[model samples]
Target: MKRIQIEKIFHHNAYRIGVFFDKDFEVIAILKRIGATYSGSRRCWYLDYSKASYHKLRFHFPDLVVVTESSNTTLVTGINNRDLSPIASSSVLQLDSTLSNPEHKQTQITSEKLKLQLLPSIGKYWVFKMHFHHEISKQLLKIKGVYWNGNYKSYMVFRNETVKQHVEAVLGVGSFFGSDYFTKDLLPVKGKIKILPHTEATSWMEVYVPKLVAVHEKLKRFSLARFSKSKNCYLLPAAPIVMDSLHLQFESTGIDIENLLPKNYLDKRNLPNKKQLDLSKTKKSLLDMVPVQAQTYLSSMIDTLLALNYSSSTLRTYCGAFIQFLRYFEFRNPESINREEIIRFLGSLMERGLSATSGHSMVNGVQFYYQQVLGKVDYSFVLPRPKKEKKLPVVLTMEECLQIFKVVDNPKHKLLLLIGYGAGLRVSEIVSLKWSDILFEEQKIHIKNAKGKKDRMVMLPYSIVTSLQLYRELYKGKHYVFEGQFAGEPYSTGSVQQVMRNALKLTGLEKKATVHTLRHSFATHLLENGTDIRYIQQFLGHSSIKTTTIYTHLTKTAVDKIQSPLDRMVDLKSKKKLEE
Candidate 1:
């Protein structure tokens, strides 16, 4: 290896990188390229004290050692004839050999594979286009204003220095950052996919996501996908796998991808809403449902619910249920409306075939206002409610559960279903899961801040742990175990439910199973296998054993063993007939 003398010294009353090396013709040419100039008096080459020259020297001669003396007070002796040797006092700076190492070069090549582009502004948002990397995506998701721009196949963030810094830090150095080509490129007008109604599953599916480049790019993955400008839609050939994948891919992007799925494919059911039912942001406000005369009652009910620190879910439910009462008694004040009127309003809801759960919520909401808000004493007459149906939860048998698992093609979706049945997690709890919750040593998954704001530990099957280990290595999710298209938010329960619905279609199961049905199956199966209900209760994070014991009613393991007296009587009759 060769040596280059690099020293910071006063050159014309300013610091410069003084170079001292032998008069090799090739070395001189390289020094000249680094902006080095020869001083006739000192008889050595010199350049400005900057990093550019230092890097250039390394790039040109990766095998050479650089001895740097940056005391800033080091001065050269005038008219030195011979080459200056290394001074004992000056510190020796070794050359960077990593630049010449093949392993290091491979690392650079791997990192360089990830490229990014700055897309045109999407309304107020600045867009960044790149291939998704979990770690890089996680950092971007940390910014509060970042959005997954599905239309652009990019991330949209609010224009700010914090976002800019985060982007620069997360994405390593690249020339793409300084490029201007993307700015001039015309972008398509963004929109969402609209599925056209079709009768047959085998027929071509028509999608209307106008100029949505992301959708266009995705369509290119399948064969014979065409854009029909005449009909203002895109027509694509149908495949069940593609349909299921399409829903799973974009559903997490905050789009209602369920609507894009064909009805015949999913076998649609009147499944209870997976969303929180918060109507606060909807266009039709609860106040709008009531007459102008009765707006105050509705407003008061909401304000009261909020003041009481009721959960947002409860607040929405009460507001929704109470609004019906307000609209019915529009002419009269809430105080004037008695038990009979309240009963009549509920009766009407029952006539409309509202579910028992909804009916109960409506009753509880009205009761809160009358008893707490109005401070009313209980009258002799009871305020009536819809009869509470003792309906059994739908449970999938062990073999049936395997069938559903077999049909699930996506690994993440499969793991999601596995966790649901294997761990017995609720739809809400499953979505809110974070990577930090998984405990390998304890063999448990921590369910924190769950229903009733309580934390509990649930068993993590060895099978799930193995899958999770492989998945974590691949995805490396920082926040949630399963993230949505956007970074920080948990996977939407609705999306998981859609995945469940899609999987059931592939299997010929007639049961109207939901994501919750997996939880029910988990509990019932565990009970059948003789897992104590008390432990099951704890594992399920149930507040009461009664809630857990419901599985007992569904598990026919014990009941199947009991022989009927009629069977015994039939055997006796058969014996008598044979004897006769």
Candidate 2:
């Protein structure tokens, strides 16, 4: 290589040009002379191929005169004649070199190839257009030459040779995506592929994010690619295999690419998968899975479940459980929940001196937290409820039942109590019973949307039917058999129980009998009449036969006492003492 002296440097059309020793720069080639601008800010020179290079050089290097211009025969005479020896050798060498070379070398850079792969795949293709600059990021399809036409809307690539050569020099490659040779359509013409870009640093790490993720996924197979502060914005090296697998999907499904990519610049390798989270939902402090507005009315969640035709008893159990749960949790939002937190909460319920029934409510509430609230229905850990005391239900005899009915003055209240005990109905089952639920013609009462939201039929008593007919004649309404004072609301279960107590007081029935005792009486009476235990189980809607079996112990045979074996033995010694 020969050194050329920089006599002068000047700018033309925002490009700097340099005039070296003996004006040998002009002897380079025909393409070099036609059009080019130079920038000489840092002593490093570059050319802008769209502008005239020589014209600008003439103004700065005025002291030198050009004598000839015949391809490689350009001659220049300068006033500085002291260094003719160095000038002669350098000038001759430069001329000989350019004249000897008819072709220029071209090498493709990996980054440019990557950019070509990324551009078409990006969903937000408009973002690139938003940052359009004439000379900075001009599209390859726009403009006649490599130079930008200052028109942002242009979409043509550089078609001129000199302009292409200029870009090749600056970018270290020429016509990457611009050429049809790399396209899928032109692979036949281009022959073998050159190279693919891969770096320890990910796309996000680079100052300019070259490839869109949609395209990157096609090029790479990655499942989880995360950005780390240690590696700046680039994807971390851990779990390369997983990320590769995910990338495959991204390539196939261009949709949801942005969702696959993480936003924060931190290692998220420990984070769970979409299906692997501990709780179906997170607590308010951790992550907001259920909307806050929805959680505010936690009771309404249960109500909605009911409205959607879930069992009324399930609604009662779930809502009651949730209410107790909120009290235990001090009415906090049900977010940021973890498995351990729930376990502790369940443990606390037993620790707090709550009954077995209360414990059941808690289990149901927490179960709902996982199922309905978090949308995670797969609960492996089960919270066992405390064992309820096996107490015999208080069932009044037929005479006692009649006594209470006689004392009850209110026709609706009396009918409600009579149906509860006489037909074996729960308070809720009784209140919710519509006129249509009563099948007097068939001597059956249909309970729809009962305990487990199940529908069942119960035998209607002849005596209660006659009383009901009399009551119906006296009272008329739209909905429930016993409607509330308000038009739509049904009579509350508690109100029915209170009315039962009042009727018992008036009738002078001394035995302790609740509205539920009426149901107990129905069950006990069935057993007393020798009805099969399994049949009774089905009638009462008990989940277990053991529940129905409890009524058998209340029967006269089960309740009757047997003489002790010790007492049955003869007392001969005591008899002899008495004879003496």
| Most accurate candidate by lDDT | 1
lDDT of 2 by residue, 223-334 (tens): 2344345533334232333343334333323223232334443233333432223122222211121234445646445545644655444554565556545544556666
Candidate 1 residue pairs that clash: none
Per-prediction TM-score to the true structure, in the order listed: 0.52, 0.43
List the candidate 2 regions with Cα displacement exceeding 4 Å: 1-308, 311-337, 476-480, 486-490, 507-511, 566-580
When summed lDDT is taken over every stretch of 10 residues in candidate 1, the lowest stretch is: 101-110
Per-residue lDDT tens digits of candidate 1, residues 1-580?
Answer: 2355665434433445567653333355466556778865345677655566667766766754455533212223222132222222232333243223212111221233344557654334566765445556787788676767553457876655555555666676434233222222345343566776444433566666645566666555444456777676666545454465566445433344435555574321211122323434321355555567777777778777767666666766777667655655654787777777778777866764566777788788888888777767564546666687788989899999999999998999999999999999998888889888998999989999888879999989998788899998888888788988655557888799989988998998999899999999998999899998999999888888878878889988998998899998999999999999
Residue 255 in candidate 1 has what lDDT? 40
Predicted structure with the largest TM-score when compared to the true one: 1
User: For residue 467, what is the lDDT in candidate 1?
Assistant: 87
**Candidate 2 versus the native: TM-score?**
0.43
Residue 505 in candidate 1, Cα distance off native in Å: 0.6
TM-score of 1: 0.52
